[model samples]
Target chain A: MNNSSSVIEPKTRPIRKSKIDYSQGPAPVSVNPAWCKACNICVALCPQGVLEPDAEGKPVVAHADNCIQCGACWAHCPDFAITSNYK
Target chain B: MSIAAKEAGARQDSDVVLRYLRPHVKFPNMWCPGCGNGVVATSLIRAIDKLGIPRDNVVLVSGIGCSSRMPVYLDFQALHTTHGRALAFATGVKFSRPDLKVIVITGDGDCLSIGGNHLIHACRRNIDITTILINNYIYGMTGGQTSPTTPAGAHATTTPFGNTEKQFEACDLARGAGASFIARTTVYHTTQMDRLIMEAIQHRGFSLVEVISNCHTYYGRLNRVGQATQLLRMFQEKASTQPKDPNMVDEDSKDMIQTGIIHRDTEKTELCDEYQKLTDSLAKGKSS
Candidate 1:
């Protein structure tokens, strides 16, 4: 009672490195000043301290490398001022 | 930063959700900075995107209030009706075209006070409409007056000495009125909000998703709840995923805002479908 036809052998594919660099992390958080209401919410809620308020209180990406890309800043931004290409 | 990073930063001007908004409408909405209404609107757009519901198939009906103004900005068939009448208008839309998804955006004042009757009746009928009641606790647009959902002992312009009456539990009210689906989420819980809104929209019977939003400009200043961030943090700290015990006293549940679906009854009949069946039966009898 051999059922060889019913089961297929698993194939092992070669592992390859992707062209995109994994070290850079996700895209830098971009704040649109035109729409920014200077809420400072993104700056306040960012866990990584990636965003900081400018002279006018608008958020700017101060530590782009520290960004874990958790999306807390953009998700919490009430004015829709924060955006990331990776999001 | 690499070339990709540079390009990402350069492309920040174009927002992913901007396509969901009306092009003619101006940027920088009228809501105050850090207002929770924006968070709710964004979460709603995300939910709609995840569901892949076409913009044309959606009809947003809103009554007069800050939250009600959401329909105006979104690029969909919208009707900004009079105060507290958003649910009634949405019911008519759903009845006429069952294919079109009707969503009502109403605020605490407009929904519970002005349109409370319509809300209960809609729930009783079990209409296939989604109502997103934004409970900001105060009338934000009209200068921070006390609303039905305003917590007792909370300060508002009308309740300067603190509200003497008990706060209305919106989810409990909806459940009692026979809504098939009743859920509550706050702006602080963005992920939960998006999921609950999507679930409510997909539900067949009357569904109500009460979004506990913050009115920073008025409610925050009046109540000294700090800025929007502080208020959102408060939500994060106080919101419990566990539903409040039915027997829990007001004092015990006062500080806790329940987050997640509280009640769901899918077996009940939908108003529009039932009405259609009745009409079809009558027409068949007449023809026979």
Candidate 2:
């Protein structure tokens, strides 16, 4: 069939689905307050409810032990304020 | 140590993501609260950071739009050029200094209407530049003018009567124009967006990622989408992964904006790469 080329394109990637490990603990979260703009995106998007915002709207490690290290905050912080240590 | 002291110590530690950003970046950022541009910016930073591309090797170029303000916040060699001309400027940068990784941040109107020529030509040439077109359906910074991607019957400030023009599917346009890598994802789908952008950055030929973001300030208020968060929820409901079957593409995702990589042609040689090979062969021929 003329469409044989397009049909076979998806097969190129193979089925090696590599899942990222978000559960490598004791993963401590590091935050630089100076870089923090008190954006609540980190607190809102946290999958484990690991972060809680203080009165100033800056995220605090309310439950550091519960962090699964998914890196949602580490990658999504507008100010680039947070980091997740997989160690 | 006490709880307060320990928390303070943890706060002092630096983040790897922060290294990509400049500490002296201006704030409060130009994008409004819940405006998806911030998320797009952060996702872009993560993609570049994940690629481990050196700061000196990366150049972020942008046109005049709310989304284009992304360059000001990053530490990359950024150029906030004229409206709808980011791609044109980026092409020049890519041609002159082919060694650098060039990225173009543009908006719906900025790219499609004004910079439309640049977009299509860039794809046709298959230049080694990664372009992220932030589509919000309206010209948010220009106070909600109807852009080329504004859906049929959608309301904007400039269009009190619902827009009758058909929306341009950006991914389809890029694909038709011969871009090597083309992906579509929304701002709310940060994880998928992150991965797609990372893949786009690493792709050899011309690449594009159209991030369907929300303009809560102007487009949201005028169109009654409520706020940024509500628009994000709507995106979640309306977005879906594209089907592998090329024929099922239109039929399967008629009601939704299809996400994920829609098209990729890995065999196509990049503009700079081809140029280098041509020059190398020419030099050899002359010597012979």
Candidate 3:
């Protein structure tokens, strides 16, 4: 039941945001907090554990340096919540 | 901006789920908390996106089941037919308009149990239709009843004593019934699943890709798998791609479930090809 529309906002910044480096390369990733169901499937499937749950349970880039951008998170996300520019 | 530049802009940043999913699809999918169905659906759309085919060229058809709910979200020419009739309808659609790329999405119970006959015959005909059969091992939509593919000793509401029946070997059934391409993949292996679906789409004849998905809400709880993530972890641990005898599928053993292209016979002429040949011969005879 904790989805985008029905869930209320904190009136501040969404903790989970993208650090997308598409202009440069495929190493960095981003999270669309509104689209994320907070299922954490991307978190669980990440081989590097590069992402971790934020306060609202949405996945945030916990270790941006560790992200290999193999696209496990991007492909496995059912909600289209995470975007990775893995060339 | 020009159309090409606009398309490139969307591609430069949008996640694949956003790039491929129908804009009108509901915010949250109806599947359970961590259902593997979403992963499979994303894998499929990603495959279509990779193939460079226009969305208008694709037709997604499905029978009733949790996995079949995919068409409602996919932006394609879709037909959500009655329960157990997807393949039959897809066969007609593919035959009547062979130019369209037809893909049938069905679940364990929908395709293997009630729609078993259509599946077998479709394979036998070697029709040019790709079947992405999502096997969650139990009927997730109808309250998690034991399905034909449920492994022995697995628990379901209908099989509280644990399932006594043998599980159905999906790829083997298709191989025997004459599917030209047979492959298997899992939601855990996202990349591989995407590649397999693409190959299935490209294959000239009947193709079947058995996606080993999880029903965490029911099959997992009753069978003692902790949650969707735990079940996926189990897949990561249990799946094996090493070359094993294709004939060996020991359901009783804890061996990694085989994941890859298990069978492909391209020499066999596809049904449409044969039909075209027949028409050609008739036309030649008339001219003579």
Model 1 has a DockQ score of 0.22
lDDT per residue as tens, model 2, B1-288: 554464455442335445656778666576665567877887887677777898889999999988888888888999899989899999999999998999999999999999999999999999999999999999888788899999888899878888988999888999999999999999878889989999999999999999999886677778887655467767887898855454555643555878999999999999998899999999999999
Tell me, by TM-score, which candidate is best. Answer: 1
Full candidate order by lDDT, most accurate first: 1, 3, 2
Worst 10 residues of 3 chain B by lDDT: B5-14
- iRMS per model, in Å, is 12.7, 10.7, 6.2
Give the better candidate number (1 or 3) by TM-score.
1
State the lDDT at A38 in candidate 2: 58
- Could you tell which candidate, 2 or 3, scores higher by lDDT? 3
Report the Cα lDDT for candidate 2: 0.78
Q: What is the lDDT of residue B73 in candidate 3?
A: 86
Interface RMSD of 2: 10.7
Tell me each candidate's TM-score.
0.88, 0.79, 0.86
Residue B184 lDDT, candidate 1, scale 0-100:
92
| DockQ per candidate, 2 decimals | 0.22, 0.12, 0.27
**Runs in model 3 with CA error above 4 Å?**
A1-27, A85-87, B1-14, B243-255
What fraction of native interface contacts does model 3 preserve? 0.41
For model 1, what is the error of residue A73's alpha carbon versus the real structure, in angstroms, after optimal superposition?
1.4
Please write out the lDDT profile of model 1 over residues B37-116, one tens digit for every residue.
88888888888877989999999999999998898788888999999999988888998899999999999999999899
